[model samples]
Target: MSTGKGPVGIITGALSGIGAATALEFARLGASLILADIETQSGDEMITKAAELGGTATVAECDVTDYAAVERLVARTTADLGRLDFLVANAGIAEQSRIASGDPARWARVVQTNLLGTMHCVRAALPVMRRQGEGHVLIVGSTSGREPYVGEPSYLASKYGVVGFAYALRMECAEYGVRATVVEPGTVDTPLTRRPPAVRALLEQMHPLAPEDVARALVFTYQQPPHVVISELVIRPLDEAVNADMPDAEPR
Candidate 1:
C-alpha cells in the first residue's frame, strides 16, 4: 500500500479516453499497469503503448458490471502483479430518458453500468486494499451528480449515487489508510455522449469538461501525500458556461 511497493495499479475501462490516458501517465511515472476493457483491439493498443513507454502493462477484457468477471480481474491482478496498490473504478456509461416516454431499458443499462458496476468494483477490490493497509480508490463520476440535467435523468442518478458512495467509503477507509475519492467531470467528449447536435451544444453551453481534464484531477488527487485526502472535486471545461441561451436549442 505504501508508495513504490509494487508496480501494480488496476484500472478499468482502460482502453480509451481518460482511462487509457491515465494508464499511460502512470506508466510514465514508473508504475506498472493492469488495464481492463471490453474492447480487445483497444486493450491491445494500450498494452502496446505502455510497453513502448518502458512500463509493464497487462490487458484483460472485463465487463465491470459482471460480478464473476470482476472477481476474476481482481484475482488475476493479484496473481500477476504480486500486490495491488491502486484501484481506479473508471468504467461508466450515460443515457437519457423522459418521464412521459421513458426508455426503461436505457435507464436500467446506464444505472447498472455507471452505478451498480461501481459498487461491484469497490466491493470486490476493498478486501485487497484493506489487507494492504494503504490504497487509493478513484471513481470517475460527473458534475451531474450534484447538478441535474433534465434529459440525462439516469446518468445523473448514477453519478449522484457514485458521489455519495465515494464520500461514505472515504470515511470508512480513513482508519485503514486507504482513501476513496470521486472525480466529477462535466460534459466530457467521449463515446458516452450521444445526443443531437443541438442537444450536445446545449450541454456544452451548460457546462463541459474533457475526459483528460478529469484525468488530470484524478492523478493530482492520487499523487497527494498519504495524509491528505481529496474527498471530492468538480472539474468543468472552460469552454462551457452556465448559459441558458438558445431556448429552442432542444427540449430537456
Candidate 2:
C-alpha cells in the first residue's frame, strides 16, 4: 500500500461528514490531501485538523457544481502535490420532498449536486489518473441507489445515477489502470442525516454507521493492490434493514 512517495489525493465535500472523516483518515495514513469544499470556515477548520495530524493538506474552495472550479481543483492539486493518486467524489446534498409535492428547484439542486457534481469530478480527475497510469476513484453513494425508498425522488435518482456512472466509469478506466468504485453506505449518522428527527431516531436505534466507518472503507479500497479493483461495496450497520419502513421520513 505504500507509494514510495506519499500518496496524493483530492476529496470533494471535505468540510464535514464522510468527506471530512476520509480526509482525516488519509492524513493518518500520511497521504497528501487536497480537501475541497464550498464552506470556507469549515474547510479551514479541517485544514487545521489535518495539520494537527501531521498530514500535508490544503483547502480548495470548490463548488462541485462548477465544472471549471473542479478542473482547477484537480490542476492545483497535481501542480502542487506532484501527482494525483485518488479522487473521492463525495460532494452531495439531500432534500425532503415527494415527487408529487416536492419543490422543483430543490429537486433540481439535488440532481445537480449529487449527480452532475460527481460527473464533474470524474471528468476532471480521469485525465490525470490516465496520465499517471494509476489512480483510484471512489464515488460515495447511498443504499438508496440500489433499492427504492419511500420519499425523496430526486435524491434517489441522483444516487442511482452515481451507481450507474461508477459501473460505466470502471469499465472505461479499466484499460488505463484507473480504478472506479462506488461505496454505498446506509444510514450514516452525520449532520446531514440528523436533520430529520424521525430518521435520526430510527438511525440511533439501529446504531447507525459513523462517518469514520465509511472513511475507513475508503482507505481500505485505496490501499489495495493496483491490480485489484473493488468495483462496488455496500456497507450498512448491523441489524439495520436496507430499506426500512419510513412512512414519514424524507430523503437524505
Candidate 3:
C-alpha cells in the first residue's frame, strides 16, 4: 500500500462504484486525493475513509457535465495540492433504451456526461500535467465500447467515443511525459451497474467483477514507470460471456 512518495490525484464520481473504489485504493497507497462528485454526503464519507487510511483527501462538489465546474475542480486540486499528478475521468451515467426508442434528452445527457465530460477533464488537466512534466490520465471506459449490446445505443456511442479519445490523447500527451490509459471493464457489480433488476440478475449469475477489481487495474496502471504506458486494458470477470444478450443496464 505504501507507494513511497505517493501521487496527488483527482477522481471524478468518487462517491460510489469504481470511482470510490479507486479513491480508496489510491489512499491505501498513500496518495493525496481530490474526490470530485455532486453527491456531497458520500463525498464526505470518502474523505473520512481516506483519512482512516492515513492518506490526505479533500472533497470537490463537481458536476462533470458542467465545463466550468470541472475546470474549477482541476483548478482547486492544483491550488491545494500544488501539483496535479493524475486524473481519473470516471464520472459517467447510463440508461437503458434502444436506438429507436431512446429519449433524445436522455441521449444528450449520456453524451455530455460520458463523452464531453471526459473531454473537459482531459482538456483541463493536461496543461497542469504538462507544466509538471509528468502525470497520468485514466479514462474509465466500458466493455460496451468494444462490442455491441442488446440495448442502450447512446451509452455505447459515448463509450466508443471515450475509447477513441483516450488513444488519441495518449499520443498527443506522450511528448509531455503524461500517460493516458483507457480501462474497459466488463460487468462490474457497482451501484451504476445494479440499476435494472433484470440486467443485475443476469450479471450476478455470471459473477460480475467488483469495483475493487477494476480499481486494482487502475492502480496497476498508475504504478508503472513513467516511460511505460499501459495504453489500454480490457478486464472482464472470469467465465463472463461476451456478447451475451441481456437487458441493457444503466449507462455508466
Candidate 4:
C-alpha cells in the first residue's frame, strides 16, 4: 500500500464528490493517500474507508484559495508521507447564476474557490513534483470548462481557467518529468451537483456522469508511463446536448 515513499497520492477536497472517489480509487490500486479537506468529519470518514482497503489515508486541512495554507499542506504531506507522487486539485464551487441577474459576490466566490484554488494547489504541488523528478496531477474539471454551459457563467469561467492551468503547466513541467492532465467530467452524482426536482430532471435529461467514471479516468492517468501526459479529456453523457442560445455573460 505504500509507494517508494509512504503516500502514493495527495488529493484535495477529499471529503466528497470526485475527490472522495479518487482517494478510494487510488487506495484500491494499493496507493497510500494524503486526503485534504476542510470538512473534518467527512474527511475522516473518507480516510476510514480507505483504511478498510488496507491503505494509509492521511487527512489534512487545506483551503486551496489560501496560498500559505496550501503551501503548508504540501510541506506537511511531504514531511509526513515522505516523497509525494500524485496530486489531484479537485476542489471547486457550483453556483448557478445567469450573467444578467447574477450576484457579483457569488461570482467572486466561484472564481476564488474554483480558479484561484486550483492555482494555489498547483503552485504548492509543483515544487514537490519538481523535487521528485516524476509526478502526475489529475485535475478535476467540468465539461462546461471545455466548451461552455449556460446559466453558470462564473463556474464555466473558473473551470476554463483550470483547463488553461493544466495545459500551460504541462508545457512548463514536461522537462521536469511532471505530467498534468485535466479530466472534464459531465454531471456527477454528488451533493455539489444535486438539485431541486425540476433542476435534477433537467440535468438527467441533459448530461449526467458518475463520480466513479471520473475516478476511473484518474486511475488511468496514474497508470500511464512517465513518458506521456494525458493533457485533456472531455467526458460527456451521450443522452444530453448543451444549450448555447443563452445570453453571454455581462460584466458585473
lDDT tens digits, residue span 3-120, model 2: 2356899999998999999999998877888889888687767877887876777888999999999999898887877789899999999977667678999988999999999999
119-229, model 4: which lDDT tens digit per residue? 898898888889889888888887777777576888889988888878888889989899988888876777777643445656656556778888888889778887876
TM-score for candidate 3, residues paired by index: 0.95
> Which is better, 1 or 3, measured by TM-score?
3
Write model 1 residue lDDT over 1-252, tens digit each, in one string. Answer: 122433578888888877887888777666777788877687677777777866678788889889999999998888867777788899887655564677888888888888888988888888998998888889988777887646667777888998999888988988999988888876677665634565566665555555667777888898999899888887877765543222222345
Ranked by lDDT, the better of candidates 1 and 4 is 4
lDDT values for all models: 0.77, 0.87, 0.89, 0.80
- Alpha carbon lDDT of residue 62, candidate 2? 92
Full ranking by TM-score: 3, 2, 4, 1
Which residues of candidate 3, in runs, are more than 4 Å off? 1-4, 248-252
RMSD values for the candidates in order, in angstroms, are: 3.3, 2.8, 3.0, 3.1
Best by lDDT: 3
lDDT (Cα, tens digit) per residue for candidate 3, span 2-76? 224778999999889999999999999889898888787876677789979867788888888899988888887
* Per-model TM-score versus the true fold: 0.89, 0.94, 0.95, 0.91
Q: Which ten residues in a row have the lowest lDDT in candidate 2?
A: 243-252
